[model samples]
Target: MERSTGVQAYYAESAERLGEVYESVSFEDVHGALLDLLPEAPARVLDVGAGTGRDATALAGRGYTVDAVEPVAELRRVAERLHPGSGVTWRPGALPEIPGVRGPYDVVLLSAVWMHLPPEERPGAMRRLAGLLAPGGLLLITLRRGEPPVDRRMFDIPPEEVADQGAAAGLRLLRTVAEGADRLGRDAVRWHAVVLQLG
Candidate 1:
């Protein structure tokens, strides 16, 4: 997919910022959500657009085999360095073109990554994402529910839109959760976490 140069630059900057914030993020919600879908036993997982290895590392620490794919070279390097001996494989590439990672993944995670794609490219991307899932495997995605900077086209698509797109991509929506606004509620981003199954 062709992105405007301005959008590319905006992502580059955002990737750097996200790398810095990865460690500080509260993963409890995400972990709880994943556990509700996945079996207790460790499973092979793929972290799509993994920014700085937070989720991948956490999963690996729990004995799950993890392969993390990140497009930003700098962020990939940072993740690799931070998680030395973490047993998580870090690949530098984007979604739909994850290098050296074979899937049939028990879980494919697209956290905070869907909104980065140009709105027009999302369905195709989701289709490819669905293809990576093992039969009955979960495709977990969390989209930020608001407009991003104008230079970049961040998809602020609603929950219904996401469900519709999931159907178009041959995915079945198993669960949808809308998080409450954060403390202060002003400019607080609400997140839509959807658990999808590829039929």
Candidate 2:
């Protein structure tokens, strides 16, 4: 986690700013690509790397049981305050090794957070996430593809490669949405969503 300092710092400092931006957007705007694939309301959802609890809280509001994992205390604090008593359980955890969170979830969402993992950890992270899915569960991942901010750290994660990782993890790809610009209209950014099922 030595290399994670920059990422941790970025989120810690910009949580408020990011929360404001996220507040102005709907969960559908961020995850509409998998609208049809998501399990019914009241299903168990694990929102890994859930920042500011926006998506998790929204899903909870719609009747889903959500566990939102965010390792950054700065963001977690703000998220807790922002969505107080929203029925979302926020945990302190990170990828490749998210601790203290039980799984077997109907839907496992990793939105816009996949690119943060170093390239070498993708396989293990995918495997770990796959292990958490219930039978026929959907693993929804959004990969950001493009150059990172000059100050922030990110990789141009390849969609095809992520698909391969899913296959390697014994998951089957269900649907792949077309690429789109960042929800915040960041020109240098593009995102692709892939829904994979654990049979």
Candidate 3:
């Protein structure tokens, strides 16, 4: 699948700025709503779209083995430098077809990443994510809710849409957190966490 041109251009140009912005927030603060759903430490994790290694490094600190998949070279470089010796393996890949990364992870996280996928790519991405989960593993997808930025490609995907697609992929919808305020202080932006389990 072709990547969104806006996503490519924007991240490439502003990777360092975005990295600083994203790393400023603690992972726990951002994912507080779904903390209860996380499996205990030592569980394998896949952090897709791990822009700056913030989430992946935090999970590593908590003793989870994390493989962070990021498609952008600039972001990956920034992430690795920001969290050296973090024990988080950086992989080059993206959604719908995460090339070079094989998984049966205990947890798969797509934080603020789903919105980047166009509508036509969602189903395939959902199926691919489901396929990467170990039996009974959790798939935590955080959906961004807000207007798309004029400079970058994004969609305010609804939780219902994710849940439906997950179901079609044979995943059980375990939980859906109500939309919460954006941690970045964007007035119009909010977030919803959708948790699914592999049968």
Pairs with backbone N, CA or C atoms under 3 Å apart (clashes), candidate 2:
none
Candidate 2 error regions (>4 Å): 1-3
Task: Rank by TM-score, highest first.
Answer: 3, 2, 1
Error of 2 at 91 (Å): 0.3
For each predicted model, how many residue pairs clash, with residues at least 3 apart or on different chains?
0, 0, 0
Candidate 3: regions farther than 4 A off: none
Q: Tell me the tens digit of each residue's lDDT in model 2 across 1-199.
A: 1138889898889999988988888898888767877778879999988888889999999899999999888889989999999999988889887867778999999988888888888899899999999999999988887777778778777778888999999999898886687888889888899889999
lDDT for each residue of candidate 3 in 99-188, tens digit (9 for 90 to 100): 877888999999989988988899999999999999999999998897878877788888999999999999999999976788989998
Q: How much lDDT does each candidate structure score?
A: 0.74, 0.87, 0.90
Tens-digit lDDT string for candidate 1 (1-199):
1234454466567766756666666556455655667645578889887778888888888788898887766677778877799999887677444556677888888887777777667777777777788888888888778656567657676777778888998889999887655322437477778888888
Judged by TM-score relative to the true structure, which candidate is superior, 1 or 2?
Answer: 2
TM-score of candidate 2 against the unseen true structure? 0.95
Query: Which should have the higher TM-score, number 2 or number 3?
Result: 3
Model 2 shows how many backbone clashes? 0
In model 1, pairs of residues that clash are none
Per-candidate TM vs. native? 0.86, 0.95, 0.97
RMSD to native, candidate 3: 1.3
Model 1 misplaced stretches (Cα beyond 4 Å): 1-8, 14-17, 29-31, 182-186
Query: RMSD for each model, in Å, please?
Result: 2.7, 1.6, 1.3
